[model samples]
Target chain A: MIELTINNIKVKAEEGMTILEAAKTVGISVPTLCHLKDLNPTGACRICVVEVEGFKNLIPSCAYPVSEGMVVDTNSNRVRRSRKTIVELLVENHPQDCLICVRNKNCELQDLSERYSVREHRFAGESKNHAIDISSASLERDPAKCILCGRCVRICNEVQKVGAIDFVNRGFSSIVTTPYNKGLNVSDCILCGQCIIVCPTAALREKSSLKIVTNTLASKTKYAVVQIAPAVRASLGEEYNMPAGTDVTGKLVSGLRRLGFKKVFDTNFAADLTIMEEATELIHRVQKNENLPLFTSCCPGWVKYAEGKHPEILDNISTCKSPHEMEGAVLKSYYARKMGLKPEDIFVVSIMPCTVKKYESARSELSKDSIPDVDAVITTRELVRLFNMAGVDFTDLPDDEFDNPLGESTGAAAIFGTSGGVMEAALRSAVFLITGKNSDNIEYTEIRGNRDIKESTLKIGDLELNVAVVNGIGNVETMIKKINSGEKKYHFIEVMACPGGCINGGGQPIHQKTENVIKRVKALYEIDRLATSRRSHENEAVKTIYKEYFEEPGSHLAHEILHTEYFDRSR
Target chain B: MNTNVLEKFPQNDRSALIPLLQEIQENYGYLPEEVLQQAADHVGMPLCTVYGVATFYNQFRLIPLGENVIRVCRGTACHVKSSANILFALETALNIKAGQTTRDKLFSLEVVSCIGACSIAPVISVNDEYFGRLAVKDIDKIVKKYSARKVSVSTANENQES
Candidate 1:
């Protein structure tokens, strides 16, 4: 431990802890813009400058280590002046369009400017004006708003391992961009959107479908239907004053209904359907001994990454459409047939905790007759914006249930929002399919939590099942290497592109603290615990859908709608 | 297409990136996007980082190089000697601004900070050969000589091709 006097408050901090972190322990909040938690510090942004007694110049507290008997004043006149100067310089170059920015009140820069009480720009210079890039359907990049914090660049290159974008050029001409400033669509971006979440300003954001959904709702000729993903339910409450992981599924339904949606449905229902088809497929693959390790295709980001970076393993990925895609297909086909409406007349909008789903919805494979299965994909953040824009009293709204047959789901489906959830959900039913009875133990506790890679082996009656789960795309390379080297063998693998699964998805509310993600994960687990039917096979609506329409889980009709193919997009 | 430039560097060795990029710039005059991507792949670095490093160093250029390059020094000594006027004079003569190449690719202009020959104030280096103690009137003479040389070089290339 190291001793430090921060603002005359003597404290002992752990060795190697930065002055910013030590100050944080003592509740001395030093504002920072470029320090990503657990990632290597860049200290590019000099916002957290502090006055150390021995140091000649104001040191960046975030990058400076706390030393024994170090005298530090975080908000001293000298430090405050330096920090304010930094903010002034950043603001001078930045655009003055914060009111119309997507990140408005939630922006870190705005918060810092307000904290520092920076009312006037002292350093006036020629501001940079760059064209806003809306080339990718999933994300938007406004280079003019970027403060050159390099947070997004680091996240993309280091954490996500995509390297889709980077800081190009030097000095005044420096900007974060793809190679040659080309559109992101041409780059190897998986569209996971981790960069958007890390962005301190409105520079990086998901391309919003809020306006389109509003137009669709207002259109008299179109019947707009919306489906909410499981992760959306787990984290949507954070947008409001409600605490993180406060499952507002019922309130979310009420809010969406107030948004003027014709019908509200749950993607969890399709998650159950995914389990039915995927479990049966796994059973067949296990018996036939073909495609030994079947990789889950639920995450569109992971799917795109696999296709582009590792096309050799494309065949190993499950052919089933993602839950939301499956829901859209079923809504267009089965639900449309039941409602006596043409597929073209019904517009489907999915409220997803994913930005990649926007790109996935536009893919040609997930469409029929040139009509996309999902017409629009709005993120959980966009849903909050819609709620706020429509003046919906989300907190006061009564708990409302989801509509009809497509809304009903099981506890196994509810757990699909977190890491290792798909595998656990599938195993609950896969064990039943192989042994004609549910597993005595339902919770696959071995494969739970935020671990990057998780694997477990179990004996289901006569068959030994081997399964693995990968949450972040960065953790996938090692697993693929093991599979190729014949060192690790598995019959099934579940991969969620975002770390800690969909609850911490890129499209969810931005959280700097890890506790919010944990709470969201716990909330999904709580839903599973409280649910009546804990297995996908036990979902009566799913069973009815199979018996009355598809005939069987992997029947020809089910394959036509639920199953999809992948392509080799390796560069 | 000259992947052989990357062959000297060990695969996945990030330390080899600077040397490899230096060699690329030495061989190709400017780093091409395709070659930069290949260097990124060979060095196991992100393409953006490769571009970042290349741009951070003023020695590297992204666009195609012209036949004759003119680098105007804007060092303290040169600035004191009114190098800005000489830069403007050159820009007018070449019909291009600093950090740009002429449409005919005969000459390119770049304003640099110190080429380490401060003894010769207001130095202008054309293709690594330094000319010192020059005035605004000297810009036209220098540009005309480079233009004349470019014509002869092209004529020789045309003769060889025929």
Candidate 2:
């Protein structure tokens, strides 16, 4: 540990810690824009500039390393002027439509402008007039609103490892785009929406399906059914001023119920079903020698990426549709039959921590009874808007459970929100199926963290099954490259496009720190461990669905409703 | 590089033109398609369109290239500084155009999109060992080094055969 004085306060910090980090440790607030923890600090935005005793110029505290006996002034006149200048310059070309912007209240730029009292820009330069690109099914990119902090580029390339977008052109005319300025829809973009989540401005946003959802809710002729994802429980509270990781599951269900939906369900129920199908499929594949090294198909972003970039490996991907999409299909088919209603009369809505599900729901192949599986898809943030629209006090609502058989889920289902949750859930069922016995060991702690890449092996019956989990696309690239080169071997692989799984998904309430993301992820795991049923097969609702409707696991009817196909996409 | 030659070439043929151009460039060090008419006959296209595609994109080579490919990144970030100097050095060294190869087939130069290392500006990757923070003075030393290494390898192979 090294001792230092920050803003006249003496502090002890770890050696090699940046002055900004030290300041943060001592509760000395320093403003920053382009500084995200666990990500490379580029010092592109000079807002965090602070005066050190020895340095002539105000140095960026974010990138400047703290030395022994360092004296720092966080809010001196020089520091203030520099910080204000940076904020003013950022606001100069920035779109002044803060009132109507999607990120109006939640914008960091807006907060900084208010903090620095930057009412008007002195150097209002000519703003770049570029058209918004909304061609992608999952995201919209407005180059005009881009501050060029390159957060999206860093998230997409450095964090996710999907180099789909790069700084194209030069200087004032420069823009972030894929090769040849091709539309993101046409490029090799896996619709993860991490870029949108990290973006400080409204330059990047999820493709809004709010209109479709609102239309369905407003329609009297059709009955709309909604399912909230597990990770959503830990995050939905953030939109309502509740702290991050607050399990607002019951309140979320109640809010959805108040929105006039015919039935409020949990995707955890389908996530339970996914485990059953996926685990059974994995065992079957191990026995059959047909597409060894089965890949989990839960993340739509990973699935699209596999289809677009690695079409040769399509056979390796599990045929199972994501839990949300599976629930939609099941609702349209089984639930519609039970209600004695036509599939068209029922509108299935899925609230997910993903933007790719927007694209997944609209796929031509996902339709079962001549109607699309999921009629509409909305993010957790969009759900907050719906709650507000209904005039429901999210905090005041009594905790309520989801309705009936479709609402039943296990702890395993709940954990599926986090990064390694899917792999761990699969292991629970896979171990049982292989041994034909319920083992006391349920938690596969090997794959249970927020690491970008995690690997483990478990002994089941006579075979030692090797498994690996990858959270981000960039990590997926390294794993895939190794797999392609025959450098690493694994029987089963779980790839979640968003880091820390669906719990920290792009559509989840945006929290900036890895520690906060891990906290939310841990809350998900804790919820899972404390729940009664820890395995998907143990869920009575899932068991009932299989026994009453589908007859058995991997049955023809089950396959038809729960599974889908993949297509090779051009790069 | 000549628009008139490309205009005279047929537009419909794609497959035959690529290989034909490759062969022509291999033999004469440039796509002298006037020496080879079989590609036009095989593809059932007039000669003009074939040359048009070859000259249209930066990927294709209508003229003879140097033996080594010296790709300088003219990407937005790289172009900001020192890149012009690097380009000027290459032009002076080879006495050839940006797209053209040396008469001795010693070097070929072209520009590319970003190489994904923005932190290290003014970079050039030769067969992908990105050299960053380059200076104009470093160009001659680097070029001479590659040339010397190539000569030594060829000599070693000759001695091994003997």
Candidate 3:
């Protein structure tokens, strides 16, 4: 430990900690742009500069390692000037189109500019002239607004292990681009949108389908139905000033009702359906001696990554669409048929905590009868915007339940929001299906946690089942390499693209503190523990759907509606 | 088109084009068009896109016959110390531009964004070897060492053939 004095306040901080970190430890606020917790400190932006008693010039507190007996002035005139100058320089190149930007009020750069009181940019020069590239199905890139903080590059390279982007040119011409400036759709990018989440400015954004959603809602011809994902309930409350991990499922259901939708449903219902079909497929694969190591296909980002980088494992990936898409398909087809409404009249919208879900909805193969499964997709952040725009008092709204049979879900479905939840959910059903007996023990403690890579083996009746769960794309790369080297042995695998699965998804609530992620994940498990139907098979709604509609699990009719295929994408 | 020449190398497995391109550049002087074309066929990529990528990065080249490659540093310290001017002088003396090899098969000139040897500003490297504290006159002496070696190799080959 080291002792330091910041702004005349004596503080004790850990050794090897940066000044910004030490200041934070002492409750001294330090603004930063490119410094993300648990990621490398690039110190590219000079927003966190501070004055040292012995140093000649102001130093960036984010990158400067603290020393013993260091005296720092965090709010001195010199420090303030350095921060202001950095903000002014950033504003000079930034676009003046803030009112229309997707991240208008939520933008970090705009918030910092207001806090620093940057009234005018003295250095008026020509900004970098680059066209906005919306070539990818999920993401948009506006290089003109990029401040070159390298957050996207770092996230893509360090976190995802997909080095599709890098610093290309030098100095003034320096730009972040894929190799040969190929569009992201044509590049090796998996469309995870982790880059979009970390970007402090409007340089990266999800491709909005808001206009299509609004059009559907406006038309009297179509009946707009919406479904909210499990992760969305745990995160939507954060935008309404609620604490992290607050379960707002009731409020979210009521809020969607206020949004003029004909029905408000839950993706968890379809998540239960996914478990039924996926577990049955695993048992069939084990029985038929075909496509062993059945990989979970619920995460679109992981599905895309597996398709592009490890195409040889296509046969191993399960043939099921994600719960969001599955619910869309089911709503437009099954629900539409049951209600005596045309499939075209039912505008299926999914409120997902994922940007890749947007891309998944647009896949050509997802269409059942020349109509896209989901009419439009919106993020939880966008849903909050819609609620506020409609003058809905989200905080004061009464708790309401999701509508009808389609809205019902199990506790196993709720846990799908967090990491290892899918594997645990699948195991619960797999053991029952394999042994033809309900095991008293449901929780697979070996496969449940926030670990990057987790693997376990168990004896289910006469068969030995091995399973592996990978959370983070970078960890998936390591696991893939081990599998390719013939060192990994597993009968089933679950991979989520984000670091902690859909609970901490890229489209989830954005919090600066790292602890908030853990808090949100904890809240999901708590929701799972408090529920009566702890297993997917135990959910009466799921049993009713199968007995009334599909007849049996893994039936040909069920496969046609629930399953999809993957293609190899080489770069 | 010569199978024997192609078979002489094992690392030239067409499946590994990008890495093989880097390796061939490291071993040979530069990536000739023929070598790049062979790599394009191996990787099943169009020759145009391969050439486009080779030209996109400052790291690649398409010429041949350079005994020693010279890379003048252009890091922050070196830039402040006018190392760019040193590079200009080397480009003029060798009569070959940056990322290009001389027609006489003597030297290849290149410029790097950084060498990471900041304390010794105005640095350059010859054939993967570092040379610091460079001056305008140093270009002449550096060129002579490689030219002399090239002359001996050609003469030795001719004598053995005769």
Q: With candidate 3 superimposed using the best TM-score fit, by how many Å does residue B149's alpha carbon deviate from the native?
A: 36
**Of the pair 1 and 3, which is ahead by lDDT?**
1
Candidate number that wins on lDDT, 2 or 3 = 3
True contacts kept of each: 0.72, 0.00, 0.00
Q: Rank the candidates by TM-score, best first.
A: 1, 3, 2
TM-score of chain A of each: 0.99, 0.97, 0.97
- The residue ranges of model 1 lying beyond 4 angstroms of the native Cα positions read B1-3, B92-97, B115-120, B128-133, B148-162
Residues A219-284, model 2: lDDT tens digits: 989999999888888878777777667888888888888888989998999999999999999989
Instruction: In model 1, state the lDDT of residue A277.
Output: 95
Compare the candidates by TM-score and give the number of the best one. Answer: 1
Model 3: CAPRI class:
incorrect
For candidate 1, write residues A281-391 as lDDT tens digits: 999998999987999999999999999888888888999999999999999999999999899989999998899999999999999898889999999898888888999
DockQ score for candidate 2: 0.03
User: Candidate 3, after superposition: displacement of residue A367 in Å?
Assistant: 1.2
DockQ for every model, please: 0.73, 0.03, 0.06
Task: Judging by DockQ, tell me the better candidate of 2 and 3.
Answer: 3
